[model samples]
Target: MVAEAQNLKVSVWRGTGETGEFETFDVPSRESQTVLDVVSWIQQQADPTLTYRFACRVGMCGSCAMMVNGIPRWTCRTHVKKVSENNTLRIEPLRNMPVIKDLVADMDPFFDKWVSAEALHHPTSTRNDAITPVDATTPERQAADAGIECINCGICYAACDTVAGNPDYLGPAALQRAWTLLNDAKDGGRIAILDAVSGSGGCHNCHSMGSCTRYCPNELDPMSAIAGLKRETFRHALRRKRDA
Candidate 1:
């Protein structure tokens, strides 16, 4: 038994998919320790076979996102002091994703939705064509700028309740990316992109619960982007009806 003052009681999910069980560990408490540091310590000092993922420890790379105390966060940036309750921490793989192993959630489905949303930019000009000068101050550019900082971390995807309940939902990150591309003046796939997200499983499925925005490490507002897509798709539908 660990003395309550010197050690942290950490309960970590240990298995694949829904078959996991929480394995508790008592780790020595330290000042200014990040959650990623704690996991690294566990893997290094306590258990060597523990599976997890991390790249840049400084939080630039979004590869270290995990569920800390029931909330999705970039583990590298999450200080243990800020989240631990009574010197206890609960660490697990991100929610709404298939667990490949302990702390490593498969991101294929999350990215698949990105592809389904047609979030990639389709350039209007060929390489040989002159570069199109875009005014950064334009409303479209500003809208695009607001959402272009996403690092594909999957934190927003994990926090989305729509993704949890609706398998077909395109999700906040993907929809937000689509919105950025939609506003890009040089993107040529606007029609297809709009069509992709206009489906029943797309932006319209969002409940605007703001979970994505609330948990995003990059401070992006995916909810606002989804709202924009909703408005744009509605206008497109109205135009289609008039043209019919």
Candidate 2:
């Protein structure tokens, strides 16, 4: 809770199709104020037409992620005092994405790259096959477990410098998911995933800026996952050469 109530000067982006402008609002501060709360107040009181997206205000869902003061974060958990300065804030949609409206960025491109990276697991056996139990203590499981908590909020993607520069780059989340599936004992698509990530705009293009890991809301290390992909892809190339 704030020591005293004061009006916060907030600058919010309002536009469509990658083109937009900022609208300033003076919102009354409250106890334990959150950025999402300010946005909600603006929509419900100051301007009913304000556009934004949010679900599960407790931060379980990543839908409320946005750029606050030039950094991507989950607005539901971002306290206004933490990110704001002098009772002022500049809010916008997540970067490296097409703006759908005032605060909604089109996420289709991010998800599409995820598919292209073969992030989904391919089961080695059908349901008819007997259940194959996995040993959680194994090194493979440990590696895979490290990255399975990703919620696809696209925060890492928005923080990726490569994705910001090259539209074709696979980004961090997709590669991290692929690395997780590759380490899964029952997945059968290791080779396919490796091949997919080794192609153009794949893991090789990653500049290792570390922003993905630095900005991940869940504290997942996407940069390490990408590094693992690089090592495994190299090993795959060597095996192919040896076989040939």
Candidate 3:
């Protein structure tokens, strides 16, 4: 199908530091067009000074996540045809993050939360041990695979209401990462990682809104990953109590 290219009334957020507004522009829309394409058109034709962030135009990098029409979405995949109601688009930076510029959000806290959740892998098995292989289709790997495709895009973090309410909350991405590591048979940091995320602003804070799952471009279920965390933490806590 030859998609029609219509004129779109676009609104791009401008400026930062407590002063910003949606500057309107006339953008050309086309068939199979994405929100990123619209923003790129504006940057190319309407205003060269408009600042936004995007690395890979594809959905892998997760750097193109933003607030599109009041919802967090990966601009690379969000089709304007589906989201635009009246040939109008409102683009803004992701929520709950510091705006470095117009549509660019600071992601320092997002990365820091991964560390806070102890999401990193530590070696447990020695090289001298017999080599072990993992079956990809096994229930354990499948469970870990549920949330394994995260590009660290922070869409889940920004969309999460719990993260907005509590600045210290580890958020879905971090918690999901922690869950994956916890399930990894080779990871030595499982116990410590669980302890880290079991504290204040951890998995317990998740409200089960599933905003992370809803907003995930990769379709990973973060809520399920978090639920797994809660279960594991509770089980481990009880085991410790029994030993005490």
Residue 148 lDDT (model 3): 81
Model 3 agreement with the true structure over 172-197: per-residue lDDT tens digits: 99999999888776677988988999
Model 2 per-residue lDDT tens digits across residues 1-244: 6546679999999988867799999998888889999999999999999999999998777899999999999999999989998999999999999998999999999999999999987988888998778899998899999999998899999988899899899999999999999999988999899999999989999989999999898999999999999999999899999999
Writing each residue's lDDT as its tens digit, candidate 1 over 92-161 gives: 9999999999999999999998999999879899899998888899999999999999988899999998
CA shift at 1, candidate 3, in angstroms? 11
TM-score, cand. 3: 0.94
> Model-by-model lDDT, in order?
0.93, 0.93, 0.89
The list of candidate 3 runs beyond 4 A from truth reads 1-5, 125-131
Where does candidate 2 stray beyond 4 Å?
1-3
Q: Which stretches of candidate 1 lie over 4 Å from their true place?
A: 1-5
Model 1, residue pairs in steric clash: none
lDDT of 2: 0.93
